[model samples]
Target: MKGRIVGVVLAAGASRRFGARDKLAARISGRAMVQAPARALSGLGLSRRAAITRTPRQPHALRGTGTALWSVGHRRPQAASLRRAVRGARATGASHLLIVLGDMPGIGRAELRALLRHGGLHPAMATDGRSLAPPALIPRRIFGPLLRLRGDRGAGALLRRRPDLRRVPLGAGALRDVDRPEDLRPPRTG
Candidate 1:
């Protein structure tokens, strides 16, 4: 039988570095940072698309995004949000999950498509020459360890433990994520 691919966007961070505002909602090039990746996922034609966050309510920031609600409890850690997304993906009979961070402004549909093309049954992540990070594709067989996670720590733990995780190299631009105001700057064109 063929497998179903589910798109899961992780957007529940406190954005402590962004001062008073949620970085995910922050605009880069006049569009919310979260929307960049959300739009990419929507373009993938996945069986289901879910965005997970711990905010009390879906941010007005996400209005009209078209991604479904997959929120975790308030005050919960990032792991909680991830667990919720994973469980929901499993419930929908998804065989693989494509996990992308919500604050990434450089995420494009082409880059997302590249990740899926290289990712096989095992976990596959995008690396920016320095470290492995999201825009990762993880198979159901690896979901067990993800459910055992706690706190705000994300897939780093799993990647560290599993040296076997495949990595697909991406340019620095595609790997850049928004954390502070400066990170929202448009990429240099010269």
Candidate 2:
């Protein structure tokens, strides 16, 4: 079945904890880390529904092809950015939203598509058998909860507030993201 979900790439973050630069803009496989998530979403046919970024004054390089550029208000937390993304997704008549992170360079398109096929209104979250985070496929039924998100944590907190979360295992790549200088370095070619 076709997933009615639109993809939202959260490319807005301060990266203050990392302290080098915007980690999402850091490179991987000859492209910015943000590009990986953007490409993955494009591959899934959600390119037309994407919100590439929520930071104003960023280089055009950060904005991938066919993605809408938006600012979630500077100095705001990640949840604010998420709220903006969900609103955009809803505006496009999407039944669900696949929230992909800007720093998750290793998330495969197929895995996301698998989760999409199984998505539902009870909050289908991508987990690595340990913790859950984006890329989460949130149904429109949870849009109100998403709008109520706070700080930079995003929707994982919502799962706690609302029981009955459908957990989808994304394996190792789902648990990975570019958070430090070392994280952006290319893995050794064996």
Candidate 3:
């Protein structure tokens, strides 16, 4: 919280499980799923904010949000996009990298703010009282390990293994991500 924190939205994943359409482009509520995460990060007014995508064309939802769009090779692994974001953040003198998944429309400003508040000087990641995952706040010092991540691997595993990682508890459904079309449906109310 003392230094510049750059928010990075990882949106380059191929929607293999979401059928032919891009999952990030799909609407949740009235907004594109990807926009939810980007808007949240943008609202924080960090030193800088960027969204990584597989295409050079920017998403309509990101327009006017002041979040820069960075494109990586199509179908590249999650780590490739993440590494690209990390490098960009470092270039801008970011002291911490706040990572959010574009598919996780459920994550909002509240959860993100919590991560920053409890993040301290070490890495802090959101937990649903169970598994450790992103919407992670990672210090610049940890960027080296993130740059070494390979293939489809993400920071989740690495964060889980780190003794210095702080787990910030969020609501049960806060980390829910849309993987299939069915996941977009609102919860049934009995």
Candidate 4:
């Protein structure tokens, strides 16, 4: 039987490079950048949809996109926040957790579904041919090590330890995360 799958949007980035504005709150295609991933994951009808923030006052838009709000308290590292989100997801009886990045406004429902398909059997993560990263599906078997993660390393450390990560090929759209002002530009036309 397939285990329950939960979605968690990691929205706690400091956006130090974005210059004076939170990238997740920046508008992309007329909507908050975080909304894209939130909607994509929520549309999958996962066991639950949630967003992790560094503080309580971050932004209120994610909640409207159907994601429950969570905070890791003050400016904790991404890994710490993710660890807390994982524990919260497990509490919902989830056997799998889909870690989505809030800044990836181009991620869509189809991409999330693709990750979910392989994630049911083993740990799966999306790859843009250069690196395997979030928009990943982590199985419960590694939840312990995941919870043990600390500092700003995020999940890369855990992924590196396990060579079994199923790398799912994803399009440039799925990999386009908004980190700086230039990233907010409109996509070029064919």
Candidate 5:
């Protein structure tokens, strides 16, 4: 796991749509909403993992194993989250960064590995082209775009402006983010 890419979880949202409570701490089945992404990223063994929260508040339950990563605090805006995330990870020798959302519980470890592998060749965004978005694989060279990203929607436009980038479609999970109480519930199998 030497020199593997860093995985960044963007958990710094206002959670306004989620109503009360820090959505990052909201539980899904047995895990907090934010825990879902951390769980997936922790297994990657990339030597660095970081969660960008409104504060530097990382999941303490997730701490202990040195393999787990740092939590960075930000006082404003989602764009600040990405900028801080990339900068912090870069300080620790991250060659590339794989950004995952705090709300997509369905995104599995296998898919993340695939995303990282595919990301090595292309700077890609995860989407099914409907609603959920912002997850992606970003090269250090593209740090400018990440820093430039602003507003509530996050980095989607940054990817679009870069015509040289390639995108990988990871299906619904890539696009599925939890913004409401209904989002935490499992889909009906029917």
Candidate 6:
């Protein structure tokens, strides 16, 4: 909580399962999917913020969100995008990196605050009690491992194997991410 933390949004996924349309561009509750996470990160006042996307041009939703947009090859692996973010953070002298998925509109300011509050200098990830995932906080010590990550995988597998990883419990619904069209639908009310 005391060090310079850089917030990064990983938005370069191929969205192969979400039909021909771009999942991150899809809207939920009147806002673009990617905008939610980007906006959330912007509100935290991190030392720096960026979004890694597959498009060279900045998306309209992210234009005024205060997150610098970096592009990667659409076919590139998830690790490639992560490496880019890590390098940017390192260049900026950040002490920690907050990794958030652009497709996950469910994770908002509250969930992120909890992760940082409990994370401190240790690697911390959000959990729904059954599985570990991001919006994760990675201290500078683990940036090496993150740079070595390969093929479609982010820090999930690496964090899982770390004994020092802190699991911040969040509501299951808060971890929901958009993969398919139906995933954008609001849950039914009783």
- The lDDT leader among the candidates is 6
Candidate 5 TM-score to native? 0.83
Put down candidate 1 lDDT per residue, 1-190, tens digits, no spaces: 1369999888877778889977887878788889888888886768898788775477776778788887786677888888888899999999888998998878888888888887676778898888888888888998888999998778777875787788888888998888889878777888
Output the lDDT of residue 109, model 2: 81
**Reference-based lDDT, residue 38, model 5:** 73
Comparing 2 and 5 by TM-score, which wins?
Answer: 2
TM-score, predicted candidate 1 vs. hidden true structure: 0.92
Candidate 3 Cα RMSD after full superposition onto the native fold (Å): 1.3
Between candidates 2 and 6, the one scoring higher on TM-score is 6
lDDT for model 3, on a 0 to 1 scale? 0.88
Instruction: Tell me each candidate's TM-score.
Output: 0.92, 0.86, 0.95, 0.92, 0.83, 0.96
Q: Relative to the true structure, how large is the alpha-carbon lDDT of every model?
A: 0.83, 0.73, 0.88, 0.82, 0.68, 0.89
Can you list the residue pairs that collide in candidate 3?
Answer: none
Q: Model 2 misses residue 109 by how many Å?
A: 0.7
Model 6, span 17-85: residue lDDT tens: 999987888989888899889988966769999999888899787877889987886799989999989
Candidate 3: where is the Cα deviation over 4 Å? none
C-alpha RMSD in Å of predicted model 2 compared with the true structure: 2.6
User: In model 2, which runs have C-alpha deviations exceeding 4 angstroms?
Assistant: 56-58, 185-190
Model 1 global lDDT (CA atoms, 0 to 1): 0.83
Tens digits of per-residue lDDT for model 2 on 1-190? 3546688778777777678676776667777777767777766755255654555565465554556676776678888888898888788788788888877888778768867766765667777887776778888888887898788668778765666777888876555877778776555655
| Model 4 misplaced stretches (Cα beyond 4 Å) | 187-190
Worst 10 residues of 6 by lDDT: 36-45
